[model samples]
Target chain A: MRRLAPAVGPLLLGLALAAACHPAVAGLLGDGGANRPLSLTRLSDLALNHLTLAASGFAFVACLGLGLGLVVTRSRFAALRGGIDTLAAFAQAVPPVVVVALALPILGFGGPPTLLALAAYGIMPALRGTVGALESVSPEAREAARAVGLTPGQVLRQVELPLAASGLIETLRTAFVLAVAVTAVGALAGASTLGTPIVAGLQNQNVVAMFQGTAAAAALAFLGDALLLAAGGLARREAA
Target chain B: MRRRIILGLAGAAVVPTLLVLLPLMHFAPNRLLTGTAIDAPSILGAMLWPLGALAAIGPGLLAGSRGRLAAAIAALACLGAFALLLAGLGHGAAAWTAGQPPAARARLAAGAWIGASLLAAAVPLGARRVDPAAGGPIGALALAASVQGLWLAGRLDALSVVVEFRARRDELAAALLDHLALALGALALAALVTGALALWRRGRGLVDLTVSGLQVVPAVALLGGLVTAASALLSAAPALRTYGLSALGTVPALVGIAAYLLLPLWRGLQGALRAPDAASLDAARALGLTPRQILTGLRLPLGASVLLGGVRVAAVQALGLATLGALVGAGGLGTLVFDGMAQFAPDLILLGALPVIALSLAAERALSGLEAAARRHWPS
Candidate 1:
């Protein structure tokens, strides 16, 4: 934690400072001719939508990923892990926007397609993190817990989960950040997001709008990164 | 063993359940409108029996198989069953579209794609129960052979995706070339930049920081920022526009992609360079080998696999990210994807997406093979 502080401190500070200055940046860039600049309230609203979509999708992916990871790590389900790991790797190689575009046909446009894409794209990181974190828990510890006559469920809840907490938190953080990124791409699918301005501005050649949108989107990602980093820091400290 | 059997049985149940629950195909009068659905088991009369037989026998073999060879054979049977079901769908589509206009499309719908994908997934998942490595090779071979046979028999000619391909053959070729160029160009740029930086020991910290900072920004935001910056530059010196230094299109896309690729490439190179341990380096030094000779003779050979591993990741990511080039008017396959989104043409979107997926997978597999070969030869 101490070593991480030097790196984390400046990153957090820089992101926050950049994010804090967005309104001023927007003002400086000015509005493109005949196009209304996104007001602070509108930008906040879009950011909220972006976060909401990311959080909702992250929630679904977290549950699915954690469940799958737990199942595959069990002794009986070991054989299934290799196949799933391969599939997850393959899925991760596809770009998030392409996933959104592919889902658009099946789910139609708007929030549903965006949500589906977010879940699909985010699953790989979450699952890999969970499996890795769980696997990192020493076998000796699990054996000790079992030797104490703790049931499999009890061992998992009391022994494994506690040991895995920091790793799990880190996984969630990575997965959440990924969800945030995918939400920005979800703008192409007509989901109202920080990416909305970016896409609209691109079509209209509104440079100011584009800049503002890009800034806000970056701000959202940075904010998410900071919050998650703090949470991960707390987890690491608790574990220590 | 009981769990494996249960899993096999559950896998076998997926296709039949999906077939009943969802429509097998969607038929549109033209490309513009949402189509009516054709359900399998209801419309495909005699084809269902063979599919049913294969499904049952595939799972039975999985349950009965105690050896890796048997499990592999079971995987092959399951994949062949999936192929036969798809061929049946193609035949059904042909029958449905017999009297329709040229614009009419009869394509496999959500059910077929979802069901077939699940079934395909099941083959490996089931086969791997006996042996972890038993499934993939057999499944791929079976899939390729059946797809080829179906294509040669003209069984898949009526599929809307095939029809879409036929209609846009020339445009598809151009898009393919553009897509390849964008991805490969960005990869080459990243390789050169990272290679130079990796050798500059004094600038390592700053380079790492810059790469991480670039990664922190989302790809879209990075691309947008590049567009803004490039436009600013071009406007400041309009003379540069004549030299093809435009704000939008290929320039921003290429730069953004290369920026993202830097971190992976740099990390991989660092890992590879460090592959020779302290003892090995000390021994090489004691042997009176110069630093440059040590690098080429020991580090390069030993670290080849690690380097290739990194390149594999960056290359695959580049291919995927290049699709966004279309968004900036660079005119890659993503143009088809976005155009499909705007026009609500699913086949057009598939035409773009499937190729990108294939390209990424192919790069991944090819690089992995090379990495394995490196590890074999060097044993590091």
Candidate 2:
């Protein structure tokens, strides 16, 4: 409670902004259509689109990053090892616009490239966290597992991985939050994500629509972040 | 065994480089070098001497002990000056040929000459000792000046470069190769810096600080804010507005992308720094080793794996964000995506998206390799 006081201001401001930009309220009161009733179908459609896009991309990023992190951390090949780090750095340095532009000709517009972009962007945190967590595991515990007649695979699964699960979860949470935030930017590539309304709103100079889109994107990000944090906390508790 | 491992590791880096380049070459236009008989040859000819000079500085500065630091500083200064000179010369020539006033042209010419002269002079002084206190201020100034010069040069008909290349498939291929080369150069520089920093106390702090600053900001919001700020400033400033420089494009987008890419790198660094336990420190100390010996012999070696992890994070993040550079007309894959959007061409979009995805996958593999090497070399 005491530590959270510092975050209160930002939290309140965000909530207020979201409320002010609520699509239902804005559509009814703003200049575009005072008479037009707020439709649930439209809202649900937007929500579904957002969820699908987020889920597919976020899952890929999480899995890829996690697996890469584990393999790199444990692998024995010298060339493969050096190559991995360099590639990761290279991937990160390449701008998202460049990535999308390069991908456009191959993946086509709409969802595929957007998903690829999101996955690439989201992988770093999860990958890094996975590596960090696994490396942080106690050598004594590993030795104990070996002494207890556990094979390498069993030791990794039942002991090392379990111990590192909390950290991995935290990494996933962070990646999820980042993915949610970036999904809105997918509108630039013709994805019907939350950014579509925002871009359209901006172009049309429709403040209400802009607010609605921005609010929705921000709210979704916040909600996603909250859920991740909760998941991380639960994982940590379980680990403890 | 160590030599063999190193050799093998070196060989692996070539595969990804080739993969990225192959596609670029396949799609490259035919007339890339056409009409370059006069200007192109001259540019290439001029570059040879400067490139030679630039190449020599690295080895020269690292030779002696007393003046080593100074030599490095001098080399950097020379590079900075040369970069500025090139930029100023390009702009001055453009402005002069555009029929600018005599006084303005003379001023630009003088500035360019002075910059070039400074660069030429600094190159020979690679043996000079650097004053540690002066290094920070000088480096900051040099970076600022270089960036400003590049920005100016880049703005002067740089769009024509993109348009020209786009007009020809061979040219586009050549340009892609050039871009990849630049990217590789940057990676090599980063690796060198990281390796050097691993050997120095001050270097570690510098690396850590750089990473921390990058990690703190959210990418999208940061981009948005910077774009807004640039637009506001440009609108307010008559001079900038006259130049037709707007924030909605390359500058802000690049800044945003760069900032986003930096976050993972910084976070990784932060983690690496804190990775080692106090117990390890105490144990190393108890073995009767001095602080310097302990750091080099135990701490650093152990920390290498973690540090590389950070490097991996940073690299991947950079690759992904680099795609976004096209949003502001920075070129690369984002250009295809945006072009597709404007024209509503899915094929064009896929063309761009496929390469980026392939690039990402390739990079992911390379980083994984590095991580494994780090683990092996710096095992707990």
Candidate 3:
């Protein structure tokens, strides 16, 4: 059960993506509007942009979470740690609509803000996992590192982090899946992503377009999840 | 002692300033405030005075031996003040009374009084009893004040304030103060409800049921449904037609979207409760407490981290979802996005999208602090 649970993300992603490309499925792409051939050019553009956004969001969140996780562990400053975590959670709780509304007047719109929101939303899982994983590292291992004259940074880098890597990777995978799923929502703000088709489909009540867009989104989410699971597995093996 | 007091006061001042005041200062309504046609300032003053009175009564309730009784009285006084203030403000009341005969005002006043009385009766009963062992009265007062501040901030119209500020930049400081108060009210209400619920239920399913159900509903679909429902209700009932509920766009859409965003927080808390260590449960049981006692005294304290963690998630989600409010005429960031889309203006879209993103990032940072605090006090 445990082993298979990890495979769900990847399996779902692959199947959905593959299904989107089938000839029988071309009817689902929604009106296709003026863009003819339903060609590989558009598909490639989407795949590339989607991947880039996902990657950027993923990388940003991972780094943010890492720094935050480290700060939380090293600093005995309870209030500071508490404050940061609360902020992150509140950020997570806020409806994406509200964030966009609140941000519109200040930051304007576009790829940057959308990416920023995705990155922000994505960080929580990884940050949380890092904290939990690091805390769970055996105290004895930490003490051994200390007794051996390892600096605190050295202890974290050489001992605690490596031991906690598997858990951290799992957390990142969850974040990645979430980011991929929500990236489509970026279309609502006009980021020129796959969600554009879906939104257009909804506005026009075009079922084919809606199906195409939804299928693409679901596929992307699944693929992203799968990739993360594979990465997590590989990391676990490396740790072992 | 002085340092601690100073620190507390600073926090009291700073939090509202950043979250509510700053936003309001940046967006206070210019036309409404500047126009001589309405007694807007006087109305506002009338509202604030009674609210201030309510705030004053809070401390006495917290301090007295008959705390529950005192709180009940204070709550009643607050409700009475709120009614008087609302009546004096006139805008909300006028809107409510529109198209209705003058005779309805008496009924409305009576209804308001009855409602206030019921709310007062409910407050003390719902108040969480302070743990006798948990430090001094100062801590309790601080908690109460914090709650009040948050409540004040959250319930305010931040968008209107921001719009006002944009139009009248000179009044930025006052606008910001008002906005802060509103945001504080919102935060306070959320905190109080979530905190109180956490204390009472301790690992129960209410949060999960509410939040997860909310999560599964897609935002667009939810908004559509809400708009449809609002239109139907308004058209079907003559009374609602006066309020213009059938008006399409931002308001209805935003309300729907906001409703949809609540699920994750609810579910997140539920998930957190389920995530706690089993050993802690056994330990509580071993201490000779009943299940109810165990939950209130032990599990709740232990689970505070997770519960709050859930809240942080919900709050961030809510912030993001609020941007979509503009689609239904609720008017927030979605207005920018939708308008940009209509006109094919990338700059406008970027303008709208950027703020949503920044707000989300900022919210994430804020919630991170809450999560950390939860972990600290309720160490796994």
- Highest lDDT, which number? 1
For each candidate, what is the lDDT?
0.81, 0.54, 0.53
Quick one: ranking by lDDT, best first? Answer: 1, 2, 3
lDDT of model 1 at position B132: 49
lDDT of 1 by residue, A106-142 (tens): 7877899888778777778789899999999999999
* Ranking according to DockQ, highest score first: 1, 3, 2
Q: What DockQ does candidate 2 have relative to the true complex?
A: 0.12
Q: Specify the CAPRI tier of model 3.
A: incorrect
What's the TM for model 2? Answer: 0.50
**Candidate 1 local Cα displacement, residue B232, angstroms:** 1.9
What range of 10 consecutive residues in model 3 chain B has the weakest lDDT sum? B19-28
Candidates sorted on TM-score, descending: 1, 3, 2
The deviation in Å at residue B255 for candidate 3 is 10
Q: What's the lDDT for candidate 3?
A: 0.53
In model 1, residue pairs whose N, Cα or C atoms come closer than 3 Å (at least 3 residues apart or on different chains), thus clashing, are none
Docking class of 2: incorrect
